[model samples]
Target chain A: MRLILRQRELVADAWRYAGEEAGADAPLIATLAELRTDPERHLARRGALGVRLTPVDRVEELATHLPRLALVACEFPGPGEGRGYSQGRLLRERYGFAGELRAVGAGVKQDLVFHLARCGFDALELAPGEDPAAAVRAWQRYEVGYQPGAAQVVLRRQRFFAATPPA
Target chain B: MYQYDELDQALVDARVAEFRDQTRRHLAGELSEEEFRPLRLRNGLYIQRHAPMLRIAIPYGLLSARQLHTLAAVARRYDRGYGHFTTRQNLQLNWPRLEDVPEILAQLATVQMHSIQTSGNCIRNVTADHLAGVAADEVDDPRPYCEIIRQWSSVHPEFTYLPRKFKIAVTGSPADRAASEVHDVGLHLVRDAQGQLGFTVLVGGGLGRMPIIGQVIREFLPVADLLSYLEAILRIYNRQGRRDNIHRARIKVLVKALGIERFRDLVEAEWQENRPHHVQLPQAEVERVRAFFRPQPYEILADLPAPAGNARLQAWYRYNTHAHKVPGYRAVFVSLKAHGEVPGDMSAEQMDALAEIARRYSFGLVRVTHTQNLLLADVRQRDLEALWRELEALRLATPNIGTLTDMIACPGLDFCSLANAGTLDVARQIQQRFDDLDYLYDLGEIEIKMSGCMNACGHHHVGHIGILGVDKHGEEWYQITLGGSASGVTALGEVIGPSVRKNEVAATIERIVEVYRGVRADGERFLDTVRRLGIKPFKEQAYAPHPAAA
Candidate 1:
């Protein structure tokens, strides 16, 4: 699933909800900052406020808190900051966060989708107007893995090596 | 040495195939020279002043007899009959043709070796103490960890294009034989409060241009986090290190620009973000690598009786060899740096002979020292005379082990493209000038290093009387520095004065010694004399405008 919107537009829209009284029928979408500090406050008001977590200030810190949340948006601050990649890995492998894991950022190019997915981020909120089909094709570009990562390569190598025993 | 397993073997083979393809494409004009430079350098091929020099990684200077023979075979076939062992424990063959390097690399791959990451702006060969596993004072063997790093740093995607070459040296002993303080990153293994082994990681220590001792960035890094922490450091350096100027490209310069505390904080921030979820070094994997270097079974025997009527063997024992950690064993140094000879140059035949002696008498292991000497680590005491006889026949038995004649001179202008004067010729002249072995033995452990230029490639600044060549009016002039030493305690040599004309260099050195000998304060060495009464006296005596007029 893809949500094509500029990160600044999303962030600025999220800020507009700051200190406002929410109605009971508000849609189940929340700003990113509310997920960081006072996660418990948002948790208490979850159903009524229709709140969802954003990039949890720190990945490892949120690993324990992630199981309770149904939706979390993993924000990439820039093109190169890779903290969210590790965050996605921990959410999937350690905490077993089964709900939506969305990636949001500028230059969220199609090539990075495979890595994000491997790290357990299933939804991508790319820069405005990026085609989802083009992003999906990027995931299938590289079939081989030279390094052991959270990607499909490790699993494939394990199966291949297990099937072939040394003489 | 860690023998390559199937995984390592497969990776190297694949890498060779990849490089061969790259070379083919370049030759076919598909890849431009600018595009292909980094690719060739990553594979350890460099187009130097005259030819393509290949620096092969000799991880930690530990090689089995078979590996040495393989190197010898490679040298004889692909290169000139010799290879120069560098101070960083890597071997460089000066005469390998550009086209033949891939085949030479294929030969190295057969022996579980390759030239990957030996040059260019990436991590160079990770050096460690030559006496690592065998040293008496070692906390633990550092080679296994070095090998682990060697694997991690080889062709690392992120670090392939670093601003400058990176060198990391690990030393398990407190003696610092590896010169850990003078490396890009120095890892000294030490026991912590709980008796667990960890590293005191020093960063930014280097010698060239701005020689600053590395500062301790991490007081104690757990052994398990070694790789991840190194990744953190390299990542930070690769991203933030200065690339605007080649002179300021080393990580040392970065650490200098940002104070040590600030640099440490930056590395810690990177580490906090990128700490691997699973520790890279599981105990089992560490053990698997360590098993390859398990100690050989040593014989337990009494000391040998004095040799029958052979004063030469006795003299060699007295001056040339060191005691081994094992009883009835000794570490024998074969001085290839003997005055006038190029440091660490062994003819193919001499190498073959040494290989034979190693297999026969020394548990099939040979070690190359940073001081440009070869060591037979496990020589049995009883076989000392026989070993000496064989070495003597091959001209490898030079009795001046650490004396004046045992000089460490680089291939100055003779072979090195960077040199200004003829270092080998000057070395030969000094050797011929002082041919008396007895006089050399009496001089007692003087390190005279000669570099062809001020680049300090010969480590001349650390020698007792360092000679640096300068180009004066298109003619070579020699500058003398005194009191430089690398072992036990390290000091940079002090310069004497105005440079001497090339023809007057030998006579000037003789005069410096005459002043040293005339001082006559019983048992004071040349360095001690220079240290006591500054270079002022030596400068006045040696640097007269015209010695003939004087």
Candidate 2:
């Protein structure tokens, strides 16, 4: 897996993540399973702790430990599943989790990149061999959006005020 | 017709660019077909049996002369020189290449048109009565509301993908010309005792393998609460509606599974929580939309001289012209279901000619009817003879607007990938067998809907004489249904008996008509007769094996 964090590739040696699942070489990072099962023990020793949440995981439950966490990852089970999107947005706009939020799943493809970012994922963990550069242009597909969410002001509200007079 | 403002133009143009890049990524192998299928379908590109069919949205069935010309140009440039008008008042090109779809969409965007949300799980095109603004019995024009929904549902973030496709239809008149009751959501524009306009919301009426009528969810919802209320229902359906099986994924199925009472309670809960802080649609916004649909500049004058007693013109006058709200104006229907031609199919040249006539006679506006016909909304009564003659030259003057010859049929095996039998040929055979105009006129207002399969795109379940094609051991056979209607009082037809061979289908319809002619009371319609007497009389002979059956 490769991470595009804050519009930059997450290159090795900047931060070595040691986990059998990630096979990463980071010096100190809590594995996803440890963070979920034995959170107190892992919280005692970790420098930077991150937990991966599936579509079923409650973001508010993870918010209980928001002070101890630096990153929270959400996974898309498949292309058809959109629950992860709502999870991501609530973590930012509702719960105010200002830490790094990453989207990790096989279904993370170029078509969903624009929407993924708008729904508030600061980092996108693409599957192996996927190009991070191809999706960099997708976030600018539209200068405007319809529904209210994490990124742009909803167009309806914008129009309502725009249609208002100079006063 | 509504004019596009800067916001609307920007939105459509931006969508075109976005879809173009999506298509490019798909072709470049960056996006897998499985990942790209829903995206393309939402843009109305369908891979048909032979080629890609692009369905262009005719929002609320309203089109201007310039847009019609653009459509004709699209037909000539990217496809064969013809387009099919569907029962939903949209247009479909049957033979556009997959690679040319992006250019086709860009061309459509120039006319303030694109195939956005025209297909797929998103709210499909919002349809309204063909005779909406000009109808004499209408309480309020429904197009403004339809436009509000079009903008709300277009590229709607959460609902772009759903369990199944959703449809909505609105009707302003008491006559129910939009077939609202058979849609996923039916909105009937009604006025309260206080004389304020509101809507009667009907949920979950649909036709497919499961044919059901929508139930009234609310008696009267204020026009301001429309968007918020719709969002509530959609949110519930999107989250809880069945996704395990595609067959049972429509909102109608969910509405049925949980009784309408339970569904209404759930929707009410969502609405109550979301209502106070919902999207604020002020009176200015409502009036802003309503202003666009105000009555066009029409002149008041005395009625014109009737095209004086010419029998053919008189027949055309009786069948084709409808009473308009204005004294000197009338609505004229151009039947695309002429004999020897495929129903709902119009050539590019014919479309161009209609555009010219729409400019000259009817204020440059055209409307597509749910019955798969076209209408000129504000035609002058004085121009009836001249327009009829012009249409006759185009072979569009088929004086069978509501008669048996004016059948509604899906593309069937001819173009649709899902069709099981050839419906266009069956429709042609029936038209040939029943070509007598006088006899058809006597039969009086029969709707014969045909579908190739149980998907019911042909709306076979609601026709007066519904013919459903079935595959019997690899042979084409059709089942006959009687007494269905899509009118003011909507009802589904009942299957008479066993299926009949394809060769006997037309003759069976003729025999059923004979039965209606024999026993019907004076001034009774075919559907009324079937309803009163039940299907036994028609069933006795309709299912009997004909000597010619293979």
Which candidate's DockQ is highest? 2
Clashing pairs in 1: B339-B405, B340-B427, B462-B484, B462-B485
lDDT of 2 by residue, B70-179 (tens): 99999998889999999999999999987789899898888999899898877999999999899999989999989888887876655666778999999998788999
Off by over 4 Å in 2: A7-74, A85-102, A120-122, A127-129, A152-167, B275-277, B304-306, B544-550
| Residue B70 of model 1, lDDT score | 89
Candidates' TM-scores? 0.78, 0.91
Tell me the docking grade of candidate 2: incorrect
Per-candidate RMSD vs. true structure?
Answer: 8.6, 3.9
Structure candidate 2, residue pairs in collision: A16-A26, A17-A26, B205-B214
Model 1 Cα lDDT, one tens digit per residue, B300-323: 787666566777787778777886
